[model samples]
Target: MNFKHMTAAAVFAGLIAGCNVMGTPLPDPRLSGRDAEFMALAPQARVNSQFERYLVDYKTNEPVGSIIVDNNAKFLYYVMPGGKAVRYGVATGQDAMAFTGRAYVGGMQEWPRWIPPKDMLERWPHLQPTADAGGLPGGPDNPLGSRALYLYQDGKDTLYRIHGTNEPDKIGQAVSSGCIRMRDIDAIDLYNRVKVGTKVVVL
Candidate 1:
């Protein structure tokens, strides 16, 4: 594969894991110092960050077919037919998260385990101790947080995930290693709404 394709695949693959359990959480990243001040305004302010809206339009009220991620708006929409979409606030992948195409929801899980990556272990020697220590239990601190939706295409793993995050403040920003993240509550809500084999469009 050429650089663009390779880059895209790597980006999607990193997102697939959603969160890192063995490594330390990355530092908060805002677009600018002004963005930092905006974050400091309060949790409500963070949650209420301005984001563009796009309503779904079609035949049925149920979102039976596809999931769309509007990266710029920091919103994930499950497209239901008949002019309806379930929108969720999201935290996106940082420098590495850049999947621009189609994939399928191959599997879904609740309170999933987390295994740190080799590079993460290399970066943080402490992670080496936990590399073989097994997956972390699900709960407040688990990187994967509450839920995970794995993305796959053509019978292969795409390595991108739309999962829940513990940090509600991180929504609408780029911070994670490379995952389409959502608040725990919102994730559970979306989790209940989606199923295996759903179509996912990450652009």
Candidate 2:
């Protein structure tokens, strides 16, 4: 190639490189390391595309800050402004075990303790310690994975929760006792986005 042609080609390549560098900044190495460490605690399973979080076209008259749980679809949507929402896969209660209707997030806990209810203890006698000892201490192995959002109606506890689960593979299924279950990482993300008084609609 001629010298002038070579120079022009080099300039074009340089411009393209510059644009790419400016457009896509590299992720912070420190943040990447932290993410790696966090994900190591709860490994995510390979999930289907439908179970992935996405910004979807959601039209709802309910105010922004409202959480909608589509039990049949096994999906949870945190409504946002401008007819959009952040959707996440969730595990709801099985057949007759599900709770329906509206409730508000009365409280939340990070790495909350797990106490087996009377019936649960009766069904699984091995879990008697969890009841007799008050509750199981929160940790990586805790059933409440990373966070728990307690549901309430008219200031009264509803005995239900939207919580993280130790079994990430069950995210898109209906298997919980009566509460909504999310993956550990997704739970943490939702916990950070929502407040104590956020409205929840379980359908």
In terms of TM-score, which candidate is strongest?
A: 2
Model 1, C-alpha of 130: deviation from truth (Å): 2.7
The alpha-carbon deviation from the true structure for residue 176 of candidate 1, after best TM-score superposition, in angstroms, is 1.3
Each model's lDDT comes to 0.67, 0.81
lDDT of 1 by residue, 63-105 (tens): 4557888777677887766566766668787756556578888
Clashes of each: 8, 0
The 10 consecutive residues of candidate 2 with the worst lDDT sum are 22-31
| TM-score of every candidate | 0.68, 0.80
In model 2, residue pairs whose N, Cα or C atoms come closer than 3 Å (at least 3 residues apart or on different chains), thus clashing, are none
Model 1, runs deviating above 4 Å? 1-46, 49-64
Residue 159 in candidate 2, Cα distance off native in Å? 1.1
RMSD to the native, candidate 2? 8.1
